[model samples]
Target: MSQAPASGSIPDSTALETGASEPGARRPYLTRTRMAAVLGALTLVLIVVCAAAVMFGSVPVDFTRAIADRTSPDHAILFAARMPRVLMGAVVGAILAAVGAALQALVRNPLAEGGTLGISSGAAFGAILAIVLTYRFGGGSAIVPAAGFAAALISTLAVYRLGQMHGRVEPFTLLLVGVIFNTFWSALILLINSLVNLYQTRSILFWLVGSLEAPTYGEVAAVSALGAAGFVWLGWHARDMNLLSLGDEPAHDLGVDVDGARRAIFIATSLMIGGAVSVSGMIGFVGLIVPHILRLAFGADHRLLLPASFLGGAAFLVAADLAARVAIAPAEIPVGVITALCGGPFFIYLLRREGHRGIAV
Candidate 1:
């Protein structure tokens, strides 16, 4: 094992991109000031992407014309439908991405993602159950998020416990445990689907794949607030996550209450994941794709990566959702399909890259 860097010493950025024998290994750690600058640039990028996504859907909305004519279809379409969808996409994307970055830190596994922990699957199952119960009995849309959050927290706790090896989480063991949970939860979702009517099946499919079709302002607001809380809560643990990257023993040596911190991180993750999946369905890879890309460019520092991942993820999903809209024209594809298509090969590449040796967190 590589020796832990001494107290207060910055670990070499080398092993990360710090591949030995590569000239690029000498790259400097990303400073907070620089990270602030990057966040500014990322914000700009997000705004531009949002504008583009809003402008170029299946039926283009002319904001100028809509502004001049208040009663135009463009006005309703732009404000009522498209804007909410875009905002929801941004909101959910940010939630998933930011959570993914923090999650990787929690597990000290770079390959760790939202789905890797089974939170997404657990959330999906909860949402599905809510849908089924609503139709069978009688309820409102509110039950869905509640059910999803409950299921996600329970499933995640199960995985956390199952992943432990002698009281500590083994990164690979936790990942496998999550996969098993995902399969179990997914099977339940399928069983429910088989028993449901076609309408419910369509709903189940939406939760299974994912869509940003039409979200209400209320849903958007609720999700945004929850996501913001998750972000700040995780950010509060940034230094601990950084220490954890060094290894469990080293982080403990540095005074991080590893078990306590991990528990808190998992709870926050469950909240956001349940909320995001509740609104957006199983939007697979926003977490995997966004954080990994940002980590590559920004180094694995969660302080920067968390927020940057949020912005970058918002931009990425808005753009992807736009593509899903246009990719078939009039006929839309599930946003998850677009992400899965992109993330599948990316996942394979990551598995292969990290297959030889574990990432240092």
Candidate 2:
């Protein structure tokens, strides 16, 4: 691996690594030694954290016993509550982080995140609207998350369309548009909140702040399916993402259909973000923090960044969720708050050090 430039922006020297061609040999996707090592370690930690999350809770049942008595209340607690929550957190965190990485790269701004681009807020508005309507009329079953997904998709498209100027998108313009749209949606959400009753408002409040308050088995299954599909779609274009860092012209010259690829990726990522947010509220930090951390360690190559972010995000969220569980025990604080507590300050530090140049937000 080659060394990073003297600026010290990238944490590892791997960003300078280059490929050399050998006759009749397949090209390698990644060869960053440090990044591979970190990815392996993070994967191991994620596995342990997932297991711990499933086993640890208020009831505190042993995994062995829970496995033996799957039908009992304790086992039910493990299966119906903790396991689903942990699994869903893993999926959601991975998707958010991966999507964040893509958006940061696509927008060429370090400050850019899924929520910052207005997708999450749009999803929140949709979810709240669904809750409001369901409470009032009651009937359509799939309208809840479906509305959220639609809102997220529409918001992302709006951002993309509005940000485009002379056939290309400007990073600063995109950021400004996103900020404005997000504010508009937030105000609308407040109006809805004002109209709703206290109990419904309380539910919307927790959801807006972001919570993983044990989703239903059906929701878990739906989110899993969506995340898995999104991951595969992203993985297929991972190499193209690396080329995108060199700018649109070079990527297009390299035979990447820049617009088409971006379109596909944008849609898939919106689905991933919207579906996760719909199920678990607006858990922050995972998307905003995890991908940037992974980029620091793994360089800008999406081949490694994508998978590494998936594992690292999973580990980070599971750890945060564990802390949320243990911090208050019976009460159990929201996992999103815990993540923000840790990630928000780190984000500020990053901004202080690397604010002006090439920051995507």
Question: Which has the greatest TM-score?
Answer: 1
lDDT of 1 by residue, 1-361 (tens): 5566655674556445534746445446667567878899999999999999888888877789877888999898888888999999999999989888888887777767778678899999998999899888999888999999999999888987888888777888888998888888989999999998988898888888889988999999999999999888998898888888777899999999988888778889999999999998888878888999888877877788888999999999999999999988988998999998998898888888887765543
Stretches off by above 4 angstroms in model 2 are 1-29, 32-39, 62-72, 356-361
Clashes of each: 1, 8
- Most accurate candidate by lDDT: 1
TM-scores of the candidates in the order shown: 0.90, 0.86
**Candidate 2, pairs of clashing residues:** 109-359, 109-360, 110-359, 110-360, 111-360, 111-361, 112-360, 112-361
**TM-score result, candidate 1:** 0.90
- Model 2, 1-361: lDDT tens digits are 3455577484333433344334423223356665667788988989999988777776577667677986777778888888888987888888888888777777766666777788888998998899899989996767877898889989989998898798776877887898788888888998999998999988888766778887788888898899889888988888888777667888899999998888878888888888988888878768778888777755778888888887888788877888888888888888889977887897677667655555432
lDDT of each: 0.87, 0.80
Off by over 4 Å in 1: 1-27
**Candidate 2: C-alpha lDDT:** 0.80
